[model samples]
Target chain A: MNFIRMKYTKWFNISKDGLSKNNPIMIAVLGICSALAITNQVENALAMGAGVTFVIVGSSAVISIIRNFIPARLRMVTYMVVISSFVILVQMFLEAYFPFIFAALGPYLGLIITNCIVMGRAEAFASKNPIRYTLVDGLANGLGYTYVLVLISIVREALAFGTILNIRVMPEAWTDWVVMAIAPGGFFVLGAIIWIFRELTNNYENA
Target chain B: MKDYLKMVIFVLILGVTTATVLTGMDALTRERIEENQLIVLQDAILEASGITDYDDTISTFEANLEVIEAEGKTFYIDGEGRVSYTFEGLGVWGPIFGVITLEADFETIAWITVIDQEETPGLGGVVEERTYLDNYVGTSMYPELRVSRTADADDINEVDAIAGGTRTSERFEAMLNEAYQAHRDVWLTLQESAGDA
Candidate 1:
């Protein structure tokens, strides 16, 4: 019974670490490019989040399963190929079923191959962990990344376009802050989020 | 030697598996993707022709469209006599595709829609925005359309460009001009033929 409880606790901690303690975007600062670029609209943010989640989860699972077979020196290249294949699959699926979101994402969807969070998890966690743990870790990290993106997008879209998911949330009199719809806006929002999170956690030593 | 051989075989197997998976996915989605492209094109054409209530049935709208194949390209003539031409050009990153509709006079633009582009999001990608596209409506295509950073209300052929997307705006302008010039004579001839009939 104690052994089982410890196993469960380990799983919970891994998920907790991904969610807040070692959050991919806020804490580790991985995959900031897409976070900034796609957060202007809530829909784009959601679609990006979904795409990243799919890629990360798929890649982590595959990498974990094939970890033993990967040559140590050639591991990075193998990881890239696996990640890109999944990315392509996501891209094709989006193009066929969700063309609007696919078009909106444009080249950013293809750039998911370079998102460090996917690679980082594969290298640090998935390669050493069992299959189930790797899958859970991928899910946890992807969700963490997604939540941050959605939060930023809500602020950006409300301020920039006076809308959320293209629906007008702000009053007609509310003038748009054009900067909030661009890269600088993303940087400002992300910075403030990180600052607040760090302050609340009192984790300045890491920075 | 054994380890090296194993590594090579593993990589070879992975490559083959990836290729097979992608090929299968491509085959599965090819038809639907092509169909979606058609719908997007049709919708853009309808929007350009000033038809805002396009959600009902595309087939009904398509029924009134006369497709002309000339100069190895397709041009659409709606029931209202508006002519639409699809054009493609290089954006900063990839091809920018759009459909532009002209009034029967072939001089005044009815509307324009950027159907596809691979521009960087938020910057060059502003070309896809309705606000940016709205600037082309009622603009004259005579002489040539000029994308100006500054608003020139007096210049009928000039439209305001996206603030941060100057290069993309310029490329879009060039694309419109080239496409118009290429199809101008053929479109006019078709109009004349229709009039004669």
Candidate 2:
């Protein structure tokens, strides 16, 4: 009974919505561009996830702190500044500390500022909610996007490279599924994942 | 009137705050990023000269290779007269940075290594792969180098292009040729000076 009642709390609902009811990728279909671009390797997925997670949470908290004072005329511009500031910081940090991943991510690292999910959270939840709630919301949504990317990349990498995290798991004789290493492979895996996820969650759109 | 004043103030404060934060962070990381870039170029130069085994790439590069600066470009020369220099070229997506090492003749490719590139992954990204770069070894670069999907790799000036990354391959071919041309005069100058000494 206590656990059931816990679900009614504001934090719980916010987290649940971000993680499941309104998942950035599967349900809302936001940020699919990056999801497909970087999901060929699990390591890239993890690094990108961490980067995105930090930005979302950081930006959301900042927006929530100044939500009441944002000028109506310049609200969107303000969000862009904050979001891009975080993105540039991530780019520089990665370039300095993790040059290999920095080179691998290439232009996509800078594209995080334009990711719809980051802008969406800033517009929707963070702009109206308190900092405390926005923090949890940001974390949940970031992880939600991350886990899906990782799951997709696992399948893609294994089939494409005959390895998981570069560790060989398949028989040596197995020829790589070359298609699975490219954008079309991301499309196929992502489409199927969205389908399975929706069916399991009983989410159906009325046409 | 109050709304206008408040809006201006808010925008100014936000701009200043973001700029300050970014500037501060840049100050912290700028040196490290530059250092890492130098290390990468050095490592590629070392690899091109066939010095692959080492404890520290930077220290090994400093100790083993002699740096010769002339004609506005830097060159790394090993004991065997192999010469390595950095090359810059544009690819399909963005700039490609690499190191090209030449045998004593300054015509035959000793080795090639891409230090950085921004090509599409799994396609044009193959430019960075060892298998692809290996094709350049023993190929001649004088009078221009050709990356052909059809031309024979064994031909003196011909090397294989990246399959499915035709545009990138074409761009890479142009880039290598351009770099060789830019460096050719300096390479000859250095050779004359060495002979005079």
Candidate 3:
């Protein structure tokens, strides 16, 4: 009973760390390129978040399973192969089942293999941890990344088009801010997000 | 020698595993992906011809569409006498695909729908907007459609370009003109053939 309780606590802490303290997008500052690029629309942001989450969890599990066999010198290359395999799977599934989202995502979907969060988790946590812990870590980190992306997308889509998920949320009188729909807009939103998160956490060392 | 051999074996195994997994997934999704592409193309054709009720687009298309093969190109003649064809052209980032429909006279654009594009989101990507595409409708193909900055222009062939997507708009105009010129002769011949038949 004590062992099971300890295990549960460990899992909870791992998830907690991922959601807040060691958040991939906020504290770690990984995978910012995609977070910026795809957040212009809420739908795109959600699709991206789901894609990244799938890639991270899938890659982490594989990496953890193969950690014992992977030679130290050839580890990075092996990780790349594993990561890309999962990315390709995700791409094919999206193209087949969700063609509109697939088309909207375009090259950003392929860029998931290079997303720092996936590789970072594989290196920092998965390679050393057991499979169960690694899976939990991956899921936690993915959720963390997803929440931040969704938050940024809400801000961007609302300001830029006066809409969310392509639906008109703002009144007709509200003028669209064209700048907020572009790349520079992503910078301001992401910067503000990092600032707010850091303030709330009161962990200024990384900031 | 032992370390080198180990590295080679490890890499070989990894490569083989990756290939096998990808191949299995490709086989599983190939049919569905192809079907999706066909649906998208069909939707583009119907939308270009101004058919908005897409719940039965495929059946409607089959019932009304007359496919003409001319000069190794496919031209679709709709029930309303408009002729449509897909156009591929270079955009800022990647290839842009559009379906353009011509009036029965074959001299004016009846409608246009940008089926696919890989332009910068919110900027060049405005090319896919309905407003931008609607500008092409009713434009004359004689001088070919040209994108101009000034809105409410008098020229029948001139349309307004997206403010921030100048390069993509320019490329789109050039692509349309080139495609129209390339298929003009074939289209005329097909129209004549239909008239005779």
Q: Considering every candidate listed, which one attains the maximal DockQ?
A: 2
Q: Which pairs in model 2 have colliding backbones?
A: none
The sequence of per-residue lDDT tens digits that candidate 1 reaches over residues A1-207 is 676676568788899888989999989999999999999999999999999998989999999999988899889999999999999999999999999899889889999999999999999998999899998899999999999999999999999999998899999999999999989999999999999988997767644
DockQ each: 0.73, 0.82, 0.76
Q: Find the 10 residues in a row with the least total lDDT in model 1 chain A.
A: A1-10
Regions more than 4 Å wrong, model 1 = A1-8, A161-163, A166-175, B90-94, B105-109, B117-197
TM-scores of the models, in the given order? 0.82, 0.86, 0.82
* lDDT (tens digit, per residue) of candidate 3 on A48-167: 999899899999999999899898988888889899999999999999999889988888999999999999999999999999999999999999999999999999999999999889
TM-score of chain A of each: 0.95, 0.98, 0.94
Task: Estimate, for each residue in B33-118, the C-alpha lDDT of model 1 and write its tens digit.
Answer: 99898888888887666676756546846676888897687888898888888888998889999888899888899988887787
lDDT of 3 by residue, B82-174 (tens): 888889999999999988889988879988888788899799999988877777778898867878988675599888888899999899989
Q: Which of the two candidates, 2 or 3, achieves a greater lDDT against the reference?
A: 2
Better of 1 and 3 by TM-score: 3
Stretches > 4 Å off in candidate 2: B89-94, B117-136, B139-197
Candidate 3, after superposition: displacement of residue A108 in Å? 2.4
Q: A89 in model 3: Cα distance from truth in Å? A: 1.8
CAPRI-style docking class of model 3 based on DockQ: medium
Query: Weakest 10 consecutive residues, lDDT, candidate 1 chain B?
Result: B49-58
